[model samples]
Target chain A: MSHNTFPHADHDPRAVRLAARDGTLVGPTAGLAKGFVQVNLVILPEAQANGFLRFCQSNPKPCPLLAVSEPGERGCAALADDLDIARDVPAYCLYRDGRLDQTVHDVSDVWRDDLVTFALGCSFTFEHALIQDGLPVRHIDEGRNVPMYRTSVPLVPAGGFAGHLVVSMRPYRASDAIRAIQITTRFPQTHGAPVHLGDPALIGITDLHSPDYGDAVSMGDDELPVFWACGVTPQQVLMDAGIAFAITHSPGHMLITDIPDSRVALL
Target chain B: MSHNTFPHADHDPRAVRLAARDGTLVGPTAGLAKGFVQVNLVILPEAQANGFLRFCQSNPKPCPLLAVSEPGERGCAALADDLDIARDVPAYCLYRDGRLDQTVHDVSDVWRDDLVTFALGCSFTFEHALIQDGLPVRHIDEGRNVPMYRTSVPLVPAGGFAGHLVVSMRPYRASDAIRAIQITTRFPQTHGAPVHLGDPALIGITDLHSPDYGDAVSMGDDELPVFWACGVTPQQVLMDAGIAFAITHSPGHMLITDIPDSRVALL
Candidate 1:
């Protein structure tokens, strides 16, 4: 599947979402809307939405909830003018009984009145800010997914949503690592700051070369592996919760939102 | 030396300076005027002032020059009104021919016609901000001078001023360390943010306990040692430059200024 390419592409957030809805953008939306916010989609039944909200509040670093819809709601009013919960995402992962069942184009046909949509802010917002500030984003440059690890660090459990924290890693030189911390702190709605840095083992991850999820990018001898609370975390926790049914954006196939990145920056 | 005990002192910046001037506050000014900016005082002959200015500009992290005086001057008008640099500081370290010849209460008697005083932003300003923001500053709590280490990290050399960087250490849990970085970044004039965190060996320090200056603080197994560009760095570099004579505020005995700490915070 062809991903969004830069420079020649229109790179408008709404255009990307429209393409996704029309099935013309059926791949990773990583590079599609460069300066806009993209989100991790989570659609759950109203029975589990309250527990999920509590989980997100307790584990803000990992699951920084951007928007939550009313039961059976289809649009997140703050995200975009006409963002359809079932169709705006590039692709959707339909989970059943704590297992990956099938990947689908859209979920409208299967959507239920009890289904609630959640949009969790993704690291791509801060990553774009970092790049704009001239900081090198290792995974993007390497053309791979940001290496992620399931850490031994436990999340503050909220009811049925309980699990260990998951983190995404990006290696930076010592100074740049400090800088990335500052840059990311501005986007609290999007995971905010790094959860841990330096030694990976401190967070209970053993090997840098062997990430539990996503491709492992090489670390420079002088580079420090900076870890941020990942959006994948909510998915992992929701999975561990043994949810009977759920839907999420597939891997890099995020929901493109009309929200500009800087709007999220804090003073 | 009696440190300023919390909650029962005047704690006014001008009061602190007056006490210093009257020889009543003849010790470290750590807790005095808690919310006002304190500065590292450096007085040098006109011949070396230009070189020192260039050095501070080149090595900003360590020697973030806040105010520079005109030739033959002993005042920093912008730092504090009616500020007589020769007597505002509680204690002065007089360096002659690359050595600490003597420390004095005031430099008024030894003041030269060509002397130019410089006030560099001290880490205390940001440290106060950190503590206000509810982050623990180890040295203050432990009642000791902040641990200063000579590192292998070299400073950008300028005419007649060259030396490896000297860093002050502050240990914090991973999350607090991230907060500390963000807080300190707001005060760029005060050695903005940390130069490095995590392993000391990465910056070429072999032993944490064997610090070149100041008292060492304990590090918890989970705490990361955050290193900031210390004010001592400029004094060290200037000492190595072999100036005929120079005067600096003794460690922790900073110049208490009327400038409010929040005045320096960046938006």
Candidate 2:
């Protein structure tokens, strides 16, 4: 389906992904897919699947597992019945021996029998929640990607996977910061509550303006920087561990799922 | 019964209040009755009761009404069955013509037939919630009364009740401050959530060390001062309005009630 054919593209995650799958939508998936769960996709060989699963379990904040596909399975029945591993996502990164081989629009040509797909929860769910709660999400308002940084905080090593934490920055006034924490605490599947807040330097982020990934958003004088464990964390760990034959969704391009946001609220 | 002889002093609200009624527990009712709702008492003549009730309705964050007794009645059945208005509170401040006339142990001798007692929900309930959530409450840790300040933020006026909003200050690290907001949001009866947070100067508090009332606890370098609506707000209004014949519970020495803390949780 084309983007114009789906007028309510932002409301339906499936429709948005379908448009992206058809090459009609190639830009970032920030505002699109409003109420549904958008996930970080990671495909690995059978040998590293168990190790990554253990890594996710150990560091739940960064790698909050939503669903894991059986080896060679293209569809995750729990997320969406019509989901195709090869063509559903807009973009994917192919890795070989821990180095980037190429970026592709479709992974159908490289689909392997021993590959396993993992769908981990992303921060978009909580960002939607924060907006609903009348809290200003700086990055979204500024029309830029949420700035992310590599932190000094280390994740618990699982099997062979090990790396420092990756966090996304969102600036909010102190009162709004508190409210943001409260709203996000309900959605544990979506990276849950914030990892740290205030003083970017304390978390090893040297400068707020110079982020490692994504565009930096404006911060007000009274605003405090709130940090959430980013889904990019897993990719960083995978790269650091020098894993062979892995795939991840390109930054800001996610696997749109059928799960409603309300379904994940702990309350 | 002495404080030591009160068998259910730690577990039961009824036992603790009964001890206070029997002139046994005259000290601060902070730790004596855990999990029970302690209230800030205010007794005014029938002529001023309507005005004060309107005042509370207009400014709920500061003067959350737990229960109000009927005119000439010495008991509030909604709050407790055997609650004696005259003698249950450990101490009472008698105001004549808006002046501090005297401090009385009991108001039985001067109790007017047209007197109406208002039991305001106290921060003690929400403070218990914060402590239970593993948040470090500075005032509680230091064994001092929460610092109170008179702010420039004006309260909505109702008849003779009009004055600046009075707030209680508690310093917490940014993360703990966020958690405190969440925990306090659950207890709406106990002043609900914080009115403001971060810089004390923003809320019109001139100096952190010099408080208008109560002892100022040390705020660490990493901590931000969070301000909640103090139950002393009504007293401040009464003093400002210069009302005739108003009585309030002495600060920190509140009326131990039979209402359980769980009864006030909104969730």
Candidate 3:
């Protein structure tokens, strides 16, 4: 299911966590833990935790749940033995009254006993699988960010987190697109599979080059644009919900964990 | 690996053989027996048998081999019991020097000890699978033939049998195309997944409406044409090779075998 193997695909989640905690790794977490999982971090008050959990359950593709910490808890033993959610991520985004407040390197100063942590699966795992299978991921090949767009496809409603879906795009020839579907289907905890492909208009995207988020990758002739659910959907949901105070990992900055990428594969 | 579940999918290969032998079924074998495998029949003299077998082995996508009879033997118990290659199929086409010699209901009148039987898997099983999964097969819904095209993608050469790949096309929306690919990949014996999709000109087909064989189906604006390696490729190969004497099942007149379609699924 998950073709997670890569050259020197070995990393110590504990070491990376320690580095983040010591304030030495304050940049993007990419290439830090190759075979381990990196997740999107979301911190909200215990009052809104149940609703957010339901939101993830209702829309698994975009918000595939890796782990959710208990109210005031800092560590999820299922992901790592000594994980600290507030200090483990490279960077955090503080949103006050549904508006961007400030980006910070550490959350220890603002940490609250009522804060709940959520770790949502990201596309880096499936992207690794696709690469192992020799499928060309256009954005990666072009040395740019994956093109992400807000789609009109509505998510199954959840308490206080209702919104449309966001998708990450990759262009491939017809046959490779098919193989990518099979490969991604095995990883249900990581956005399972694609929600749409080919025509962008059918999914309400008016322009391919004008992506709502991430850099737009060029499409070669005859290549079909395949789309997968993105973790950014949860961020969109949070903004739409107008939460009083919430925190999330800055884009490209993630929480590195001990969970092997292969552990999430269903098959 | 096989997903061989079907309610009342039981069918005796011997009974279908008996019916065809008695002329009780003189037309196409479509829907005569459900959940069982049906095969394209090919009969050639021992002199040409080796080359034909090699051809199928070389071009697995187009000519996936199911079973081959020993010289002077018509029974392949692996597929069915009491099978008669000369009379089992509903119809047969005898080719002479690459030309259509004659169409016959039964070849028992001209049966010879040197003639060898070769059975290849048909697409009926995969079509059944796709329909079971609720993917629309355009041809069946429209009451028309699935469009066929001769692609410039050349097949691997084996002995005197060599030619371009022939593909059977079905139009689908992008999401369905991804699902179709996953479904068909599990059935390698049934032409295992599609070879090409999207733009026809990329595969050397000049027009989608003008196919080399079978009737053309209409394509909607958002629908992409997905192509699978067709069973007709071996027939085309035989014609291209200009074999002196060869026999094949007439269109839609397949040999019903007791082997369950799920038996061919690779999971």
Interface RMSD of each: 1.4, 2.2, 1.7
lDDT of 2 at A145: 86
lDDT of 3 at B20: 74
Q: Put down candidate 1 lDDT per residue, B1-267, tens digits, no spaces.
A: 344542314567777787778777787877777788889988888888898899899998998888888877766678887777888888999999988999999988998899988899999889888988999989889988899999999998896788899999999988798889999999999999999987789999899988899999988988889999999998888778777899999988899888888888896
Give the per-residue lDDT digits (tens) of candidate 3, residues A114-201. 9999899988888888898898888888988889999999988887789999999999887788788889998888897798888899
* Cα-lDDT of candidate 3: 0.86
- The model with the greater lDDT, 1 or 3, is 1
Query: Backbone clashes in each candidate structure, one number apiece?
Result: 0, 0, 0
Candidate 3 - chain A - TM: 0.95
lDDT of candidate model 2 versus the reference: 0.84
Provide the TM-score for each candidate, comma-separated: 0.93, 0.93, 0.93
Fraction of true interface contacts that also occur in model 1: 0.77
Which regions of candidate 3 fall more than 4 Å away from where they truly are? A1-10, B1-12
**Which prediction has the highest DockQ against the true structure?**
1
lDDT of 1 by residue, A1-267 (tens): 355432314568777777788877788877676788888988999899888888888888888888888888888788998878788787899999998899998999999999988888998899988999999999999999899999999999895888898999999887899999998999998888998887788999999899888999988888888889888988888788788999999988899888988888885
Error of 1 at B207 (Å): 1.9
Docking class of 1: medium
Give the docking tier of candidate 3: medium
lDDT of 2 by residue, A151-183 (tens): 999899997899999999998876677678878
Residues forming the 10-long window of minimal summed lDDT in candidate 3 chain B? B1-10
Give fnat of each prediction, in order: 0.77, 0.37, 0.60
